[model samples]
Target: MGRVAGKVALVTGAGLGLGRASSLLLASEGARLVVSDIDEGLATHTAAEIVRGGGEALALRHDVSKPEDWSAAMAAIEQRFGRLDVLVNNAGIAIARNIEDTSLAEWRRTMAINLDGVFLGCQEGIKLMKKSGGGSIINLSSIDGVIGEADLAAYCASKGGVRTLTKAVAVHCAEQRYGIRCNSIHPGYIWTPQTENYLRDLGTLEQEKAKALSRHPIGFLGEPNDIAYMVLYLASDESKFVTGSEMVVDGGYLAV
Candidate 1:
């Protein structure tokens, strides 16, 4: 029952979707959770949920794209938890515009949240983890990072950057004997509010939903838990040998 008993983990964007799912699952399995989100209310709600479920949890207002915020978050975690064992760089945004149509602003925003955010989290997380004998770092990439789609240029680029960045960090940690493991997860189509918003922007809700479903041979969309379970494995000691690896939870979407 206690897959990660007594470990402390910080999850960015823990208030929503996959992040929320991962936080809940980790807490359920006996990990103390640092639930972070840009939205203070959502963060509080998530932490409250965990606590109500008789789990250890703390909520923090975190803007992952801001280096200063990362510093403050680390300070808070160190103060409250004394050490950190896991960092899930799960906070990200998607801009469904092709390169030509995507504005500079949009592209920059995507990179800031999706790519820069992960970079900052890793930097600060490594510092905390090293003090505690290292930990696991999971960066959430996407199937688009591996197989490109024309409309997802900016999103794809940021995720692709994350994919490679994870490997580089893994290599450095291993060579330095940091005991920390870094990996990336590439998820295909999981039904989340972000996807709903993206789908709304694409076209008719039902039509686009149907089209999206057709791409995945699994015959259905995924839930946040689909990705969360994998995050748990990576966060746990069971995956000790796993580092610098890309775990795909795309429901066979990448197969076709």
Candidate 2:
């Protein structure tokens, strides 16, 4: 029951979807949580849920793209937890525009939230985790990170960056003997608020759902828990020897 007993985990985008799911699971498994999201109300709700479930959590309003916000969030975590054990870089945005159709501002916005956020999380997380004898950094990439989606050019680019960045962070931590492990998770069409919004923007929700389901090969899309379980494993001592790895949880979408 106590998979990560006494550990401290900070999950970004804890407002909803995969982030919310991961935070709940971590808390259930005995980790104290720092739930940070751009929406303070959402973060507070998540923290309240954890508290109601007999877990410890702290909620904060944070903008991952801002260095100042990162600094402030880290300071708050340090004050409340005294040490950090896990960092989940789960906040991101996806643009459904191909390169040809994508505006400069659109591309920049996508990169700012999806790519820059993870980069900052890694940098700031490493600094704090190093002080606490090192920990795990989980970056949320996507199947698009490994494969390309013509309409998701910017998302694919940012997630691809996350995949490679995770490997680099892992190797650096190992070389520095910091006891930290970093890995990326590539998920395939998980049905979340973000994904739903992305799809609804493109066309009819039912048609988009059918198209997404057909690609999975498993007959259906994945749930947030599917990814949350992986997060649990990575956060636990079970994955001490696992680092710089790309864990694909894609209902075999990449196989076809």
Candidate 3:
């Protein structure tokens, strides 16, 4: 049997990138997936892929920053599966701007998706998970959450918020004996379509790749599967005791 066999999972921002990778991986491990994304087409396509692979999945158009969407998403999940077993809050936006260059609107938007989204997901996921006796909640953070970046003030703040919010949720669940575990996964420079766009904007994909590899002791940039594997582990019973922790999959970038 697969690691997460028979579980029900909801993954946000699952249209592409790390979120898509996580959804596919979880489904492969036998979890019935609810894949939601702002991009409806991508979400539907991903769900189709999962179904073709002999896994169960559903697609929903959802905007992670909105609480109404969260509520509706949960309601849909309940109607379809009757119970929720895992929630992966993986929707986020990255804006490369210094403190002075960042607009208030940009900052607020980032916080809404990256920080507020996690809070809402945890809150709703906990309520549903409690009914089922337990569940796993995984929040997607970044190396920026643990360290400082020159042009990523807002992104860093939002991720840092996620890191702390994850701990708070974990503590609350433990104190109330909810049998739920909450944790954050921090990744650094995983190559995704968005990252490709960033590299193209820089006009030097190879140079940027070289630079990213140089920072990591492993001498290679991480792939989407690298983060997906860690997420699957956290979602599975294999990480039963892992709560309120920050699992870094940074290719040793943080170690140095």
Candidate 4:
């Protein structure tokens, strides 16, 4: 139960879905949490839930795409918990569009949130994590990042950026002997609010969901906790030797 006990973890996009699940699980495992989301109310709600579950948590409104927001969030973390040991750069958005249909503005916006956000988080997180003698950085990529989707061009591009960026960060930290480990998580069609919205937009949620299910050789979609457990493992000292790796929790989706 105390897998991450005594650690300070910050999860961006902690308001809902995988972020919410990860926050709850990490808190239950005894990590003090900094729950940050663009939506202040959602972040507060998640934080309150953590506290109710007998965990320590602080909620803050943070826009991950903004450098100033990153500075403010780091400052707040320093003021509250003093150091951050685990960082989950989980804030992202999905735009369902083909390459030809995706406008430049749409591409820019996707990159800003999904790619740029993680970049900023890693950059800022490294500074504070170094102060605390090292930590783990978990960046959420997707199976689409490893493969391709005709309708998710921008999302694929952004997540692909995250996948590579994680490796780069891991290598740099290792070379500098900062004791920080960085890794990317590639998840399949997890049944989250994000996926729900994406499928709904594609018309006939049930049919789209079935199509998604058929793509996974495991025969079903994933739940939030499916990914949360992976987050827990990476956050714990058990993965001390693991770094710069791609952890795929895609229910055998890539196999087919």
In terms of lDDT, the best-performing candidate is 4
lDDT of 1 by residue, 142-250 (tens): 9988878888899999999999999999999999999999999999899999999889889998999999999989999999999999999999999999999999998
Q: Candidate 3 — which residues are off by over 4 angstroms? A: 200-203
Residue lDDT tens for model 4, 127-164: 99999999999999999889999999999999999999
Could you estimate the TM-score for every candidate?
A: 0.99, 0.99, 0.97, 0.99
Task: Tell how far residue 212 is off in model 2, in angstroms.
Answer: 0.7
lDDT tens digits by residue: candidate 3, 1-256: 4999999999999999999999999999999999999999999999999999999999999988888998999889999999999999999988877799989999999999899989889888887888888999999999999998867789999999999989999999999998899999999899998777755655588887777679889888889999999999999999999999999999899999
Q: State the weakest 10-residue window (summed lDDT) of model 2.
A: 211-220
lDDT of 1 at 135: 98
Worst 10 residues of 3 by lDDT: 194-203
How accurate locally is residue 100 in candidate 4, as Cα lDDT from 0 to 100? 99
RMSD of 3: 1.2
Model 2 lDDT, full chain set? 0.96
